[model samples]
Target chain A: MILIGEDLNVMSGEISRVIKEREPGPIQQCVAAQTKNGMDYLDVNVGPVKKDPEGTMEWLINTVQEVTDLPLCLDTTNPLAMEAGLKFCKSKALLNSASGATESMETMLPLAAKYSADVVLSVINDAGLPSDADERAASIMESAAVANELGIANENIWVDPVLLPIGVDQRQVTSYLEFIQMLQDLLPGAKSTCGLSNLSYGAPKELKSLLNRTFLVMIGRYGQHSAIVSGFDRELIRLIRGEVPEMVELIYRAMDEENMDISALPQKELEYVKTVQVLMGKSLYSHSWLEV
Target chain B: MMKYEPPLEKISVNIRETVVGHGEKALKIGGENTLPFHFFEGSLPNPPGLALEILDTEPENWAPSVLEPFEDVVSDPVKWAKKCVEVFGAEMLCLRLLSADPMGKNGSAEEAAEITKIVADAVDVPLIVWGTDMEEKDAQVLTQVARACSGKNLLLAPLVKGNYEEIAKAAMEHGHAIVAQASMDANLTKELNIALCKFFPPEKIVIDPTASALGYGLEYTFSIIEEIKQFGLADKDKMMQMPILCDFGGDCWRTKEAKENREQGILWEAITGITFILAGANLLILRHPEALKLIKEMVV
Candidate 1:
C-alpha cells in the first residue's frame, strides 16, 4: 500500500544541479513536501554524475533520511551509482531495475542478489520491446524465470510491463493490465508495478497527477504495488473509477488525436466527472478546461 | 497417348496433434481435408496462423516506420503477445527468437530454451518456434526447446536446404513440425519437399516458398506457390503436398508495398492482397491486424 515517487531523478537540468551542489534545500523541500504529502519512498536518481556520484548519492540519502524513516527506491541505470545509493540507505530499499537482458541481468542482478533487494524486472530483453499485451506477458515470464533461476524468491521480484503514455497510445494501460494478470497467473504471487506518472507524463499539468492516481487505482486493483506519483491531494485519492472511461478517452484524445477540445463538450464532461466523484468518493472541482 | 482421368478424388490430409518426443506441449501442423492448392471452395479448416516477431537485441535501431507502432511491444514481448491474442485475436502464435542470432546478441542455446518455455506457458495456443537464422545455432537452440517442450505440440520452423537435414532430423526425433523453406522455385521446392519427406514425412511438414512482396520479388514467389499447387493437383506428388506457409507480413513490410512510397507506388495494398491468395498459402503470417482481418474475411 506504500506509494513511491519516481520524479526525483536528475534526468533534467534543475534536479542535476540540486544533487551536485549539495543543495539539500530544494531536495529537503521535496522530501518534506513528499513526506507530508504521504509518499512512502522517494526514488533518488542522479543520472550518471560519476565525478562525485557517491558523494551526491550520500548527500541526498542523508538529507531525505533526515526528514523521514520512509524507505528509498534506488533509481539509476548505472550499477555503481545504485551501489552507492544503496550503501547509504538506512532501511531496506527497492532496486529500480534488474531486467531480463544479458547486460541488465548481468549488471543489475548481482546488486539485487547481493542486497536481497526487491526489484523491478522489466519483462524485456535484447529482443527489444513488444507493442501488445501478450509479448509483454512473455517478457514478464522471461524475467521471472531469470529471477527465479538466480535464486531470487518470487515475492522479491516486481514485473514492469512498460506503460505507454495514454495520450500517445490508448491501449497502453490495457496492455499493461493484461501482463499484470498474466504475472499473477504465472508466478501466482509475483508483484506487479509501473510508475503511475508515466501513464500521463506529457500532457496538461492538472491532467498529470489526477490521471496518475487514477491509473494507480486501476492497476492497483489487480495488485499494483508502489506507483510513482507527485501529490497527495484529496482529489487525487478519492478513488475515482466511475467516469474512468470518459475521462480516459478525453485525455487520450487531447494527447493523441487533438481532435476535440474539452470546452466543446460541456454537458458530457460534467456528467462524466460527477460519475467519477460518485464512484471514487473524491470531491472534484470541474474547471471549464475538462469540459470536453 | 495419355488417357484422360477424372479429377483425383479430393481428400483431406490428416494433420495430427504431435506431442514433442521430449517436452511438455504438443506439436500440430498437418490436417488436410483435401489435396494441397485445391481451394476450389474447399474448407481450409484451421485459420491462418500468425507468428509474433521477436528481436535479438533491444531493437534500438528498428526501421522507424515499423518501430513507431510496435514501440509498446518491442519494449516487452510477453505483454505484446498477450495484446496480440486478446486484442488482435491471433489464432496460432509464432515465437521468433530473432535475438538468438549469433551476429546480434550471439545468444546461447540455454537462453533461447528459457525464453521459449516462458512463452509456451504464457498461452495455451500451439507455438511455432523459429531458430535465429543460423544453421548450427538454430539447431542447437531449437533442440533444447524441442526437448524441453517434449510432448507439447509445437513446430520448430525454417529448416532450409543446407540446414534442413540436421534441424529436420532433430525435429523428427523430438516430434515437432519442420518448415521447409525454398527460394521461390517450384522445382527447388519440390526437390526440398521430397528431401524433407524422405526423412520427416510429408504429414509432419509445412512449406515456405520464401515470401516476397508485391513489388520486390513477389511475382517469382507467386509462381513458385502456384506451381507447387499445380504439381500437387496434377502430378500428385505426395512430398509437395505439405501445407504452404507464407511470411506475408514480414515480406510485405520489408518490401515497398506496405510502406509509404508516394512516387509511382501504385497498387500497394491490392497487390499485397493478391500475392498470398494466389500462392495458395495455407497459413499466412501477417503483421497488420487490419490487413489480417481483411484477408480472413476474404478467405471465409
Candidate 2:
C-alpha cells in the first residue's frame, strides 16, 4: 500500500503559476498530505512539458526537491528534462523509463545502470501499442531484454503495460488485465501500478463509478502493489489507513481462498546451457547455478 | 486501396446440426474464406437465421417494444413458443429463462424441465435455452433444460469458469450444442473457446462474443468479435474458429431505441439490424417482423 504521488505537469491548472510563484507551502502541503496518506515516494513529473521549454522544469524540480526529502520519480516526457531533474535529485530516485525502443535503449538506460536507480519501463516500443496481451508481452520481454543487455539488474526494472482509458475503448480492459497478468508472470518481483480513475472517463453516469471501483478490485488482485487513486476520497483512505493489519488479509484473501493456481501460464523459456564432459553430457554451462 | 494479406487466416468452420425447426433450413454456421457475412468471397452455405426471444416468466425489466409482441404468452412457456413461431413467423426460438434469475422467483429444476418439454412439444422449432446469466443457478437450471430437450438438438449457452463442468456433461448427454459466451473480451472469448474444445467438438460449439447495440457500447463489442473472428480464421485456431452468433436483436431491442416509440419504431429497429449486420453477427434474436424484413433485404 505504498503510495507514489503523481504530479504530471500538463495537469494541475496552476502549474505555470507554481513555476512563477515558486511557492513551497502548497507543494510542501501536497507532499505532506501524500506522506501522511502513506506515500513512500513523491513522483515529480514535468510531463508533456514542451511548451515553455527553458528553465521552467529546473525550477519545479529544484523547488519540489527542496520541499520533500522523500524520493522522487523524476518523471518527464522530455529526455533533457529527465536528465536535468535527475542530475539535481538528492536521493537514489526512480527513473520513469527506458523502453524496448532502440532510441530509449541508447538514451535513458545507461543513466539507470550508472545511477543504480530503479527504472519503470513501459511495455511499449517502436512496435507500437499492442492491441492484445500476447503482443504486449512481446514488447515487455523486449524491454526486459534491453535492460538486461545494459547490465541493469533484474530487480531494478519495473514494466508498466500502459494503462489505456476504457472510455476510449472498452475492449481494452481485458487487454489491460492480460497485460498486467503477463507483467506479473514475467517480472515476478517488481512494482506494478496504473492510474485508477481512467476507466470511467466517458462511460455512462451509472456505470462510471461502479466500473472504476470494480476495475480497482480486479487489478488489485493481479499483483498491483501500488496505485494512483482519487486523493479526495478521504473516508476510503482512512479506511485503507486504519486497517493496516488487515492489508495482507484483504489482498491475499482470494489467493488464500483459491490458492490461485497459475497453471494457465505457459512454461518459462529454458535457459541455454552447454554441459562439461565430466557431467556425462556435453553441456557447457555458464551461470547454470544462478548466483544469488 | 487497402490491399492486405491475412496470415493464419481462418479457412472455414462448420457448426452442424443446429436444427432451426421442422420445415426451416438447417442452421449450418460456417464459411471458408471470410468473416461472417463476407458473401462476396466466402461460400456461406447456410444463410444466417433469426430467433424470436421468449421467456418462461415475465421479465421484470424489458424494453416495452420487446414485451409488446409477446405480452399475452408470458404466463405459459408452450403458448409463448407457439405464439413466437406461429404469429411471429420466428424461424427459431431463443427461450431466455427469466425464472432462473437468482433475483427472480427462482424456478426449480423440475419446473424448468417441464417448461422446456412443453415448449419443445408445442412448437417443433429448435430451442436455444439460455440461463438467467447467474453462474450457480444457471448451472442448475440449464442442466435440467438440456436434459428435457435431449436429442432434440437444442443449444444451451455459456458454460464459464463456474458452470462449464455441469453444462458440458448435460450438453453431451442431451446431444445439445454449447454456446461459448465471452463478456466483451476477445482474449476471454479465445480462452472460453479453448475450454469448450476440451470436451466438445468444433461442430457442436457456437460462440457468443456478447453483442450490444451500436451506440450503447456496440463498437467495443464489435471489435472483440472481429478479433475473435480474426483469431479463428487467421490464426487457424481450431477452437477459436467456432462460428460466432451475436444476440444483438436481443441486445438492440433492450436498449433505448427500441423503447423510444414516437412513431419511429420501424426506423429505430432498422438502425439496430443494420448496425449489428455490419458488426459481424451470424445469428440474431429479434421481435419486430418489420425489422427482420429490413435486415433480410439488406443481407440479400
Candidate 3:
C-alpha cells in the first residue's frame, strides 16, 4: 500500500497550530517522522484556508519541502490554496479532491490538468453522497470524464468511494467494498485511495485502530490502490508492507469464507475474524462485535 | 513534419535505491521511476550496475573464448576477482561458490567463507556471493559467508523458495542484501518476494526471475522481465518493485551456438545482457570482459 501520511493534517491541534502560526519546527518534525515511518507521500491538509489561503499553503509547502522530498498531497477545499501548493511542490503533487459536483469539477480538474498533477475524484455529486455502489460509480465516472477531457489521464485520477463510518450505516461499508471491486472495470486505468480513518470516525478511541487496520486489509484484498493513513501506526504499516503475512493471510481467508474452525483461532486472530464478518456485513455492526 | 508528444504517466513510486558494499566505491542500483532507458519521461538517478562473474574453484566447462580473458587468474578466485575489477574496469564482482555443489567438490562452508573473505577483501568494488542452486548447500555456505563478511554489505544471490528463510535471516542479521531468485514465472517471482519481505526489508531484496540464454527461452525470460517491470511501475505492486538481476552469462556461454566460435560467444553474451537490460535489469552478471565492455558501451 502507498501510504499518504495523515499526521500533518490541519484537523489535528498541533498541525493546525503549526500551519496557522507558520512554525517550521513542528511541520518538519512531522515530515521527518513520516518519512522515517515509511510514508510514500505526506498530506498537507490546511483545511479550507478561508483566510490568506494562498499564503498559508505556500508557507506550508515551502516549510515541508525544506525537510523532506516525499510528494505532498495538497488537501483543501479552496482551489486557490490548492494551486498555490501545487506551484511550490518540488515533485508531483496529488490534488486532494474534486467531485462530480459542477463547482468542484470546474475549478479543480483544470488546475490538475494545467499542473499535470494527479487529482483525487471523490464519489459525491450535487445530490450529495451516493446511496449505493452504482451511484458512487456514476459520480466517479462523470467526474473522471471531465478530468480526461481536460487532459488528465485516467491513471492520474484517483477515485475515492468515500468511506463512511460502519457504525452509522453497515450497508454503505459493503457498498464501498463493491465499488472498489468494480473500480478497475468501471474506470479502467484509474487508481483508488480512501481516507481510511473515516471508517472509524464514530467508533471509540480504543477501537479506532482495529477498525482502520481491518478495513485497510479488507480494501487491500479488493485491490484498493492506496490510502490516507496514520503515520504512527507501526502495526498497520507492517501489515500493509507485507511484514505480517500470516495476519494478512488470515484476513484473506476470512474474506474468502474458507472453511475453518473459529474455535481453534487465537484471541488476536479471532478478533480479526469477527472484524471481517462485521465489515462484510455477515454479522450486525455493534460496538461490542469483537467481544461477541 | 508532425510534432510528436510522448504519452507518459508519472510513476508514483520509485524502485527503492539500494546501496551495496560501503564507502565511495559502493554501488547504487534501482531508484528509477520510469521504465528502463525512458529518460524522456523520468529520472534514472543511478545507472544499472555491471558485475563480472568469478568462480570459487577452477571452472570446469567454461568455453575457451570466455576463459581466455581470465586464463592467468582462473585458478585463484581472489586474483581473478581483482583482475575483473582492476583490469576489466568492472564496478562489481560476483563470486560463484560452485565448489560447494553437493555433486562437485562439496567444499565445506568454512572453506567457502574463507575464500569469500579473501575475494571480498581483495576487491574495492561491491562483491556478490552466489551459491550453487542446491538449496541445502547454499543455505549452509551462504549463511557462513554472510557471517564471515559481516558489514561488507555483500549481495547474496539465489535465495529461492527452498532456502530463503535461513539465508534471508542471516543476510538481515549480518547487514547484507539478497537476490531472491525465482523461475521464469512472474507470479512465482512476486510470491518469493512477498515471502521474503515477511522477514527481510524490501530495500535489501533484488529480484532474479531466472534469465535464459538467447535462442533458448530468451523470449520467455524477456516477457517475464517486462511483466515484472510493468507490474511494478504501472500497477505499483510493491512486491514487484525490487531491482531485477539477470545472471545470464553462464546460460549464454553453455549454448551450442556460443561454443561454435569465439565472436559468436561474445555476441551471444552481449545480446543476452543487453536484452535483459532493455527489459529492465538493474544488475547484470556476465563472464566475458569483452561482452561486458560491449554492453556498457552500448547501453550506458
Candidate 4:
C-alpha cells in the first residue's frame, strides 16, 4: 500500500499550532516520525483554510519539504490553497481531491493538469454522495472525463468512492467496496485510495483501530491502490506490508465464507473474523460487536 | 501527412530502488516506473547495471573463446576480480564460489570466505557472491562469506527456497543485500519474495528468474520477466516489485554453438543480455568483456 500519513493535518491541535506559529520544529518532527514509520507520502491537510489560505498553504509546503522528500498529498477544499501548495511542491504532489461537482471540476482539475500532479477524484456530484456502487461509478466516470479533457491521463487520477462512517450508514460501506472492485474495469489505468479512518468516525476510540485495519484488508483485497492512514499505527503498517499472513488469511476465509470451526481460532484471529463479518454486514455492527 | 501519437500508459508503482556496495561508487538500480527503455512513458532513474563473472577456482570445461580474456588471472580469484574492474571496466563483479560445491572441489566454508574477502578488498566496485547450486553447501558458504565481508554490502546470490533463511538472516545482520533465485516461474518468484520479505527488507532483495541461453528457453524466461514486471507495476503486487537480475553467462557459454565458435559465442551472450534488458532486467551477469561492451553500448 502507498501509505499517505494522516498525522500532518490542521485538524490536530499540535499540527494547527505549528502551522499558525510558523514553527518548523513540530512540523519537521511529525515529518520525520511519519517517514520513519514507513509512510510513502505525507498528507499536508490545512482544512478549508478560510483565512489566508494561500499564505498558509505556501508556508506549510515549504516547511514540510525542508525536512523530507516524500511526496505530499495537498488536502484542502479551497482551490486557491491547493494551487498554492502545488506550486511550492519540490516533488510530485497529489491534489487531495477534485469531484464530479462542477465547481471542483472547473477549478481543481486544471490546477492538477497545469502542475502535472496526480489527483484524487472523489465520487461525488451536485446531488451529493451517491446512493450505490453504480451511481458512484457514474460520478467518477464524469469527473474522469473532465480530467481527460484538461489533458490529465487516467493513470494520474486516483478515484476515491467517499467512504462514509459505517456506524452511520452500513450500506454505503458495501457500496464503496463494490465501487473499488469496479474501478479497474471502469477506468483501466486509474488508481484507488480512501480516507481509511472515515469508516470508524462514529465508533468508540477503542474499536476505531480494529475497524480501520479490517476495512483496509477488505479494500486491499479488492485491489485498492493506496489509503490515507494513521502513521503511528505499527500493526496497521505491518498488515499493509503483508507481514501478518495468518491475520490476512483469516480475513480472506471470512470473506469467502469458508467453513471453519470458529472455536479453533485464537482470540486475536476470532476478533478479526468478527470484524470482517461486521464490515461485510453478515453480522450487525455495534460497539459490542467484538464481545458478541 | 498525419501525425501519430503513441498510446502510452504510465505505471503507478515504481520498482523499489536497491543499493549495493557503499559510499561513492555504490550502484543503485530498479527505480523505473515504466517498461525498460520506455522513456516516452516514465523515468528510468538508473540504467541496467552490468557485472562480469569470475570463479573462485580455475574454471573447468570452459569455452576457449570466453576463457581467452581472463586466462592469465584465472588461477588467482583476487587478480581476476581486479582485472574485471581495472582492465575490463566492469562496474560490478559476481564471484561464483564453484570450489565450494560438495560435488566438486568440496572447499571449506572458511576457504571460500577468505578468498571472497581478498577479492572484495581487491576491487572498488560492488561484488555479488554467488554460491554453488548445492543448497546445504551454499547455506554454509554464503553465510560465512556474508559475515567475513561484514558491512561491505556485497549482494549474496541464488538464495533459493531451501537455503534462503540462514543466508538471508546473515545478509541482514551483516548489512548485505540478497538475490532470490527462482526457476523461470512467476508464481515461484513471487512466493520466494513473499517468504523472504517476512524476515528481510524487500528493498534489499533482487529477483533472478533463472535466465537461459538465446535458443534455450529464453522466450520462456522473457515471458516470466514480463509477467513479474506487470504484476509489480500494473497490479501493484508488492512481492513482485524488486529489481530483476539475470546471470546467463554460464548458460550462454556452455551451449553447443557458443562452445565451438568465438564470434557466435559473443553475439549469443550479447544478444541474450540485450533481450533480458528489453524484458526488464535491471542487472546482468555476462562472462566476456566484448559481450559486456556490446550490451553497454546498446544500453547507453
Candidate 5:
C-alpha cells in the first residue's frame, strides 16, 4: 500500500505551534522520522497557520525537500496553497485533494494537468456526503469524468469515498466499505485512499487504533490501494509489515466491550464471528471452548 | 475508447548501477526504472547479461549432456574459462569451486584462490567466483579468493545467513562484489540484502533467490523475481532494488528430465532462463551452450 505520512499536517496543536513559530526543526524531524518508518509520500498541510497560506506552504515544501527527497503529498483546503507547494516541489507531488465541488474541480484539475501530478478527488460535492454507496460511486465517477476531460490520466487519480465519523452515523461504515469496492468498477485504473483515523473520531485512543487498523484491512479487500495514516501506529504498521492477520483479535475485544455487530462479514469470516459470539455468550449463546 | 494504460509504478528507489571488472573490461547492470522489458512504460538501462558456467576441476560423474560440450577442457580451469569467452561468446564467466567442497576434494583455500586468480587473469570479461554449497568451506574458500583477486572485482557467491557476516566483511575489506543468496523467498532475499548492506554497500550486492528448474518450481521462482521487481518499481523498496542473478542452469541441468533426455535437458534450461528474464533477472548463469546461444539470440 502507498502510505502518505499524516503526522506533518497542522491538525495537531504541537505541529500547529511549530508551523506558527516557523521552526524547521520539528517539521524536518517529522519528515525524517516518518520516511524512516516507511512512508512512500509525506502529506504537507500548512493549515491556516498564517495570513499567507501560499508562502507557508512553499516554506513547508522547501523545508521538507532540504531534508529528504521522498515525494510530498501537497495537502491544503485552499487550491492556491496546494499549487504554491506543487510549483516549488522538486519532484511530482500527489495533490490532496479535490472534490465534486465546482471550485475544487475548477482549481485543482488544471494544476494537476499543468504539473503532471497525481490527484486525490473526494466523492462529495455541493450535494454533500452521499448517504448510500451508489450515490457515493456516482459522485466519484462524475469527478473522474471532469478529471479525465482535463487530461489527468486515470492512473494519476486517487478516488476517496469521503469516510464519515462512524460515531456520528454508524450506517456510514457499511457505505464506506461498499463505495471502495465500487470505485474500481466506476473508475478502472484510479487508485483509492482513506484517511483511516476518521473512522474512530469519538472513540478512545486504544479503540481508535483498533478501529482504524481493522477498517483499513477490511477496505483493502474492497480495492482500497492506499491510506493516509500514521506510520508509527503499530497496528497500522503491523498490517503493512506483512499480509493481514487471519483473524484480528480486536474484533472479539470490540464485541466484548462495545457490543458491536459483525454480521456484515461474509460467510467464512462470519463463522469466526459466530464463534466469538458463542465464546462471549452473546448471540445464540453456547458453551465455552473450555466447557467441552 | 481511451487506450487502457496500466498504472506503471513510479519507482522511487533506484537500483544502484554496478560496474564489474573496472575500466575497459567493465560491464554495467541494474539502473532499470521499470519491470524487465516493459520498454514502453520505462527504461531497461542495460540488457540482461549471460555468464557461461565453468568448473575449477574436471567432472568425473557429470551429466553426459553438459560434460560433452567441455569434454576437451574438462581437466583445466584456465582453458575451460577461455573457451567460454574466446570461443562460445560468453559475456562473462563463472568459475564454480566445486573441488573446494568438504565432501569432495576438500581442496585448501589456497588452491581455490590460485585457480580463481588464474581464471581472473585469463578472462577479458568479468568473472564470478562461486563457492561450494557447503557453508564453512565456502567462507574459508571465498575469503581466500576475495583477497587473492582483491581489486579484480570478481562477483563472489553463496553469502547465506550463516556465512554472510564473514564473507560480507571480506568483500568490503577487499574490493569485490558478493552475491547474496536465499531459497525462493523474496522477503529472505531482501533481508539478506539489508543485512549485507550494513557491512557492504547495496550497490556491491547481487541477489540470487536460489534458482529453480523449469519443471521444478519455476513458477515459484517467477513470482519471487516479480515480487522483487514490483517492490523495487512499485514500493521503491531499497533492499529489493539490486539486480537479480538467477543460477537456474545449475538446477535445470540437475533435474531428472535432463538426466533422462538430452533434448529435454536443453529445453528445460532455455525455458527456465527465458522465464526468469521476463520475470526481471538481470543476470542468468547458464550451463548448456545451446541454451546460452538461444537466450542470447532471443533477448537481443
Candidate 6:
C-alpha cells in the first residue's frame, strides 16, 4: 500500500487554526509525525476555511518542505490554490483531483500536464457519483481520454470511483469493489486509488478504522494502486499486507458473507483467530527503560 | 524514450525490527521493505549475525575435516565456546546439546541444564541453545535449560510441531525465545508459527525452515525462505514476520563436500551461509571461523 497521509487538511480544527494564524509549528509537527510514520506523500488541503486559499496552500507546502521531502498531494477544488501548491512543491506533486466536469477537465488537466504531476481523477461528472460499475467505468474512461489528449500519461493518472459511505447503503461496497475491478480491466494503463476513509463516513468514529481497513483489504486484493489514508495506521498497512494473522481472519470473514458474522466463521478460521489473540496477549520480554 | 516501470508494488508491512541480546550485545535484524540487501529500495537495518557452534559432547564420529577447525575446543565445550567469542570475534555462541540425542548419550535434561548454566555464566554474548532433532528430548532438555538460565534471553531451538506447546511455555515462562522449525513447506512453516503464537509472543519467535546442505535440496530451502519473506513483507502475515535462522554449520559440515578436503569443506560452508544470507536468513550458524570471516565480508 502506498500510504498518503490524510492529516494536513483544513478540516482538522488544529490545522485550520494554524493555517489561519500562519502558524508553522503545528504544520511542521503534522508533517513530521506523518513522514516518520512512513507517509509516501502528504495531502495538503487548504479547505474553504482559508480566505486566502492560494497563499495558505503555499504556506502549507513551504512549511512542510522545511521538515521533510515527502511529495505533497495538492488537494483542492480550487485550481489557483492547486497551482500555487504545485509552484511551491519541491518535488513532483500528485494533483489531488480532476473530475469529468468540463470546468474541472479544462483547468486541472492542463495544470497536471504542465507541472508533470500525477493526477487523481474522480469518475464524477455533472450527474454526481456513478450509480454502478458500468457508469463509473464510462465516466473514468471519458475523463481519462481528456487527460490522455492533454499529454498526461495514463500510468501517471490515478482514477478514483468516488466512494459512497457504506454505512448509509451497505450495498455501496459491492458496487465500489466491482467498479475497482472494472477500472483495472477497462482502464488498461491507469492506476486506481481511493480516499479510504470516505467509505466509512457517517459511521461511528470508533468503528471507522475497522470499516476502512476491512474495505482496504478487499480493494487491495482487487489491486488498488494507492490510497489516501491515515499514514499513522501501522496496523492498517499491516492488515493490508495480510501480515497480522488475527486481522487476516477479519478479511476472511468479510469475504465469506455480506453481513460478516465472526461467530459464524468456519471452525478452522475461528480457531486460528483465537490462537493469534492468545499469542498476542503474552509478554515476550522485559527490558529496563533506564538503560539506553 | 519513455520506459515502463513494472508497477512492482512495494511491500507496506515493514518487517518488525527486534534485537537479540541486550545492551551492547544486542543485534538488530529484519527491518527491510525489499528483500535482503536491496538497499536502493529498502533498508537492511542490521547485518546478519554469525554464531560459532560448540557441542556439549565430543563427536568421535565427526568427519576429520569438520573436526580440524575445532581440534583444540572439541573436547571442552566451555573452552570451545570461550574461544569462539574471545578469540574468533563470534557475536554469539550456539550450544548444541548433541549428547542428549537418544542415539547418543541420552543424558537427562538436568545434565544439559547444568552444562547450559556453566556456558551461560561464562559468556557475556547471547547464546543459542540448539537441541537434538528428537522432539521429546528437545522439549525436555530445553525446558530445563530455559528455566536454569531464566533471564538470559537465549534463543532456544528446534521448536517442532509435536513439542512446541511444551517448549514454548517454557520459553515464555523463562523470558527466552524459540526457533520454530518447519519442513521445507511454507504453509507448514506458517502453521508452526501460528501454533507457537498461541502460547508465545510473536516478537520472541524466530523461524527455522530446516536448513539443507549446499548440493542437497538448497533450492527447496531457498524457495521456502523467499515465500516466507514475501508473506512477512508483502502479505503482512504477522506470524510469518519473525527473523529467519539458517543452522548452516551442521548441514554444511555434514555434506559430501566436507568429506573430500579442508578447503572444499570450508568453501561449502561459506557458500551455504552466503546463499542463506542472500535468501533472507537473519541469523547464520557456522562451525568454521574462515567461512564466518568470508561470509561477514559478503553480508554487508
Best by lDDT: 4
After TM-score superposition, the amount by which residue A33's alpha carbon in candidate 4 deviates from its true location, in angstroms, is 60
lDDT of 6 by residue, B1-300 (tens): 999875655677776665666557866666677788777666777888888888998977677887876788888888888888888899988999987888888989999999998988888888999888898899899999999999888889989989999989998898887798987766567667777766688888889998896887898888879878977887576767889999867777777768777888889999988888889888889888888888888776
Clashes of 3: 0
Per-residue lDDT over B1-300 for candidate 4, one digit per residue giving the tens place of the 0 to 100 score: 989988889788999999999877799989999988889999999999999999999999899999999999999998899888899999999999998899999999999999999998888899889998888999999999999999999999889989999999999999999999989866567667877887899999999999986988999889989988987888677788899999888888888899999999999999999999999999999899999999999886
Instruction: Show where candidate 1 strays beyond 4 Å.
Output: A232-234, A238-292, B1-300
**A252-279 in candidate 1: lDDT tens per residue?**
3432335454356687454444333322
**In candidate 5, what are the lDDT values of residues A58-120, reduced to their tens digit?**
777888899889998887877768778888999888998988999889988899999999999
Looking at candidate 6 chain A, the ten consecutive residues that score lowest on lDDT are A283-292
Model 5 chain A TM-score equals: 0.83
Residues B197-226, candidate 5: write the lDDT tens digits: 766888988889887878778888899899
TM-score of each: 0.45, 0.55, 0.53, 0.53, 0.53, 0.53
User: TM-score of model 6, chain A?
Assistant: 0.85
Interface RMSD of 2: 17.7
DockQ of model 2 vs. true complex = 0.04
- Tens digit of per-residue lDDT, candidate 3, span A119-208: 999999999999999999888888888888999988999998999888777779999999999999988889999999888887768888
lDDT of 6 by residue, A1-292 (tens): 6778998888988888888889999989989999998778898877543377677776778889999999989888888888888998889889989999889999999999999999999999978878887888888888898899999978999998777665344345577777887775787888877898886676556556656776676677677888999877776767765578675655555454435454786764453333222212111100110010
* Model 2 spans > 4 angstroms off: A1-94, A97-292, B1-26, B59-64, B249-251, B254-257
Q: Categorize the docking of model 4.
A: incorrect
Please estimate how well model 4 matches the true structure, expressed as its whole-model Cα lDDT.
0.90
Error of 3 at B223 (Å): 1.0
Best by DockQ: 2
- Estimate candidate 3's RMSD in Å: 23.0
The TM-score of predicted model 4 comes to 0.53
lDDT of 1 at B103: 78
Per-residue error at B209 for model 1, in Å? Answer: 36
Q: Which is better, 4 or 6, measured by lDDT?
A: 4
- Give the range where candidate 3 chain A is weakest over 10 consecutive residues by summed lDDT: A283-292
DockQ list for all candidates: 0.00, 0.04, 0.01, 0.01, 0.01, 0.01
